[model samples]
Target: MADAGYVLPDEELAQLQKLSSDFEPETTGPLVGERQSSAAITTEYANADPVYRVKTAALPSKYAYFRTCRGDGHCGWRAIAFTYLEALVREANVGKFEEEEARLMSINNLFNNVGINYELIIDFAEEMFDLLHKLAHSVSSNDGNADAILLQAFNDMGTSLSIITYIKFLASAWVQAHPADFEAFITTGDVKTYCSLSIEPSQCELDYVAVGALSAALIKPAGFAFEIMYLDRSAGEEVNATVFSQPTDQNGMLLPNPPTIRLLYRPGHYDILYKAEDFPPPVQQQPIQVALANPYNDSFIPSESSVDIMAMIPGMYSTSFGHRWPSVPYEFDASPTPQAQVTPVQPYTPTPASAAPVNTSRQDYMPVHASHQPNHSNTGRHGLHLEGPPVTLPIHSLPPPPVSIERGHLTLERGGPFRPSMYELEQINVPSFQTSIFKNSQYNTAHYMNPDFQPEAWSPDTEYGAGHKGKHKPPAQ
Candidate 1:
């Protein structure tokens, strides 16, 4: 019997019992439910070969399109060839291969067997995608010669761009996935050997990958700042008006911008752009002179406080010197020292007005010494006498007058004969080699008399003489 409140139908009750049974595992063993089932589904999907799928989708499109399109024979053939090549590469890069045992395996086996990195396989996939996109969008409808040339150029550019993009992506992914291996390889500094297998020959191909990998390894982001110095040529001074940040793309290409600082003279305007990290520490303010002949082509010369205007330009001109901020050190020690000490002296004071009135007239003073007359006028009187030699004026001494002589003749003192000194002749010495040869007489006589008697005498047999010959003799000899 069923309760009155429950009102359960027979079919509905059976369905609920089934649902409960499914939710609860068999009590006899262990419970296996949705988690395990979901994992199995994910594994199956992941294990399915991606390369096979790419090729299956790519090849049919490659062949079917060319068969249907009716175009210029030459152009059509070219497009067909490019399509076939793209398909072949995509096929090689994609899908799983079946074995004789009918076992399924991951497509990675294809790349792995060839010693290709798995990430490079992905990059190749991406590269094919780009090439296919370009091929689909190509507009080669015009049959003119110009159109043909343009089409060829575009095709070449496309190929180059695609190849470079593929290499960059491949290197980047390999480095990222196998960081430890990449680090060990990079430490050798011969990455070219390791990378040569996968890397393209063009520098552009490797640029992005190398930059990205190095940026990650070094952990330094590239940045640039421009210090804009405005020059007032008339005033002969420069003012740092602003510092501008240069904009760069994620891939590190600089953006174009107008000149930050304007100057009266075009050549005077200078912009020095350098990496922020590479810039040296700021030192004393260095005055720079800029030549203004050609605005684009100018020269920079540094000076202390002012630059020579004449050096900048050949013509003479006055220069104005201006500085935004002086780089001089301003702080100093204020402690007192012995040499800098200050002394205080007492002020002179006059006598009080009430004490005395001093005479002001010149006649009030008396002389300290007076002439005295002797009391005894007789010649026999004893008197104090001073005895000393008579004082005489010194005679003025004058230098002798200059004497001019003829060019060939030598001047003498007043009038005297010129004579050569024996000391001067004795100071001269003859060379030892010359003295030795002269003593022997044989060598000196032949040297002086015969025009061909040479100091550097040489013949094939005795070319360098005994001294040089012995020094450079062959080991066997």
Candidate 2:
């Protein structure tokens, strides 16, 4: 066996020898020399167990190959472990590892522990296609309108739940980020975080939430009609005109009507209309005139013909003069009576010798007659002469009497005691010759007896007229 063709090559035998020398047996089992010889023999034995035997055929060699080089020339332990895990996966039906599931799971876990980061949240949203797919599949499988409704409800519920969950998560995140604010909230016991968060909710938010459950129960799909009644407590008894209109689309056709909404008010409510068409016409009226009546008696008559009877009809009436004429006229006689003629009495005149000097300065003079002369022989001392009776004489034949001068004393004589003469009697001038002698005498007496008396001064030339001889007998001296 050593020299024949079955013998190994030198390099090969050397390699075998090296392998055998390096092999060491346990002390309790065998000696090193025997183990080496046995290992060398085992390299040739092909029928031995490869894992257990060190000699007999190539079992040891096969075992060394199996340990160092796995089934496909790789390590056997790692291969075996991988194969076991693979078998388990197949049995459990855990599909292939998905990157999307891992990503979704990571986001879900983040929100569950802390809060939703809106930035990250958008990634977990399903596509419209996916949503429609699920919805269609569910509808087809369930095959009922109720199922359709339920499906929509479920979707709505899901959206609501997601929103609510997100809100809760956000609250948690805020608390974590602001611990002081959280402590304040806890102390105050007032959870106004949503209101205080500065997120302004619109009218839709309030109304929708208020009517959410009711709306959900009543709302139906297409072809279903809804009626709702609303009582207006604010409306008064009299209501104005109410109006209803259908909101239109761009093409002018009415859009789908919203649910019917009713407004109830008091029956007698009157509404004032502002539009001209609703107004009524106004009414017209006519005017009337009144007349006054007369109250006087018909038998009573007025004095004047031009008087208005209508005016007197209302005045007082006189019954005593009713039958008598209102006015009367009287008659007068026009006759002349003859007068008797008598001889005129002459006026008395004084001779120049007896007469006092005529005051030429006196403007007023009385006319004298020849019957007024006193005899020249009847003279007193100092050329004084007695006054004869007043002579009835014609006014034109005698010289006008001297104008009587008003003075304190009368200068009757030049040297003798002054004697008052009734020269005023000769000075009297009468317009009528028929004047009574007694009346003339009375006037002459009044002048001589008057307390304030002054006799008229006579000039010597006037006393002795130009017809007489020069200064004869000084008037019976």
Candidate 3:
């Protein structure tokens, strides 16, 4: 027996055994197992892939342990994706979403210049953006709930692919925007050619050029810091590691306490690595029914701390909350089958938290109300309205478009459509092509899919008016 309550499932146990004896990408959570020492990795690789054994032998001291990701080409992107979510779970705030959203929005200029579409992946991009922000805003005492949300979102097939693919796309955009910076390193004729062959492919492991551009793009714009432990067969007694992010120019060191994401890189793969003893014990997920039984329960509520999308509703949220939605009191109607037991059948939508329509539309999905029902009486540009007395749902709750722009000739490659000799031909999780479908579709105003949506020109501070704003006439508000 493995351990009293820790018996691995038949398939999982088999995989673990295979991990020690073969070369395969880990296709699960980044921080799943306890941090394992480099010695353990070496021993595991002893009977497995000879290359891994050679690599593990060179890990530096700081990289004594690791969390390995699957080696299926996209490990680098997946590693970053996992780290971002884990950071959010750790923060548990909702408002964190809006900040991230805006940061990403600000980068539309960079991406537009790189020749990618902001339309196809926009919905997924926004959800992930909001997801992280909300987690930062949520202040749940039970962090396990936060952990569950992070894990669930990443594991969801649609989310997993959309997010990982987007990260890959972002890295590609960065490369295209700054081709001159990466020109010397690329083997292909141009950045676009290299990207078609490597970066955009879901399963292509990141190369040196991709790593630099992606590190700069993700770290600077997202405003997060990171350090990666490199365990390769290079000449080293322990795992080699390095920090990548915004550092002060004078002394050249990372700022203090900026939500660091630790990752382990062993040649072809990357994975998340948690500090052995710092964070609190991980919270476990509770059963849905038990969670819903408590009206004040917060197990299912999406973190709304940062974005405050809920707050956009007249009385839903407030900034005063430390890390959670303020609890409101409400009574539940009692039925043979308690009304609290009704489960929602719809997937969570981040657009605006919508109420299940009671009439003909989605009539099957209904929340049992004590004295009030959702008066989606009015549908506005934002979200459906929830009129009447407010109900604090802890037990249960829940949570498209096209674009424009241009494109280029994409010849085929492995794992991607355009990479030359790198990624293999495969699937397109988040298409990077710019289709000409938006013939005056009003999305052009803010979206960068059109050439007209050019970013405002920036300038250095300069002396302008003799008479400043003190004498300026106020425009109508």
Give the winner by lDDT: 3
User: Model 2, range 218-334, lDDT digits (tens) per residue?
Assistant: 122111122221212232211222323233456756557432211111121111111111112221101100000011111112223212231243211232211121111000001
**CA lDDT of each candidate?**
0.24, 0.24, 0.44
Q: Tens-digit lDDT track for model 1 on 281-342?
A: 33111211011111112111112222232123322121111111111111111222211322
lDDT of 3 by residue, 1-477 (tens): 567456557668889888866765444433333233333343333333333433443231223334455555666776787776676555555555556667667776666677677786577576666666545544444444665566666656677667777777777888888888889998757789898788876557777777777677776445567777776656533356687665333365655666767788765667666542324433121221122223223221223232233334443322222112112111122122323433344321112312222111212122323222121111111112223222333222211111111111111011121113111121142242111111111112112111111111100011121322211121111
Error of 2 at 108 (Å): 22
How large an RMSD does model 1 have?
Answer: 43.9
Please provide TM-scores, in order, for all candidate models, with all chains considered together. Answer: 0.15, 0.15, 0.46
Ranking by lDDT: 3, 1, 2
* For every candidate, C-alpha RMSD to the true structure in Å: 43.9, 77.6, 25.7
Error of 2 at 440 (Å): 99
Q: Comparing candidate 2 with candidate 3, which one achieves the higher lDDT?
A: 3
Deviation in Å, model 3, residue 33 alpha carbon: 6.4
CA lDDT, candidate 1, residue 131: 49
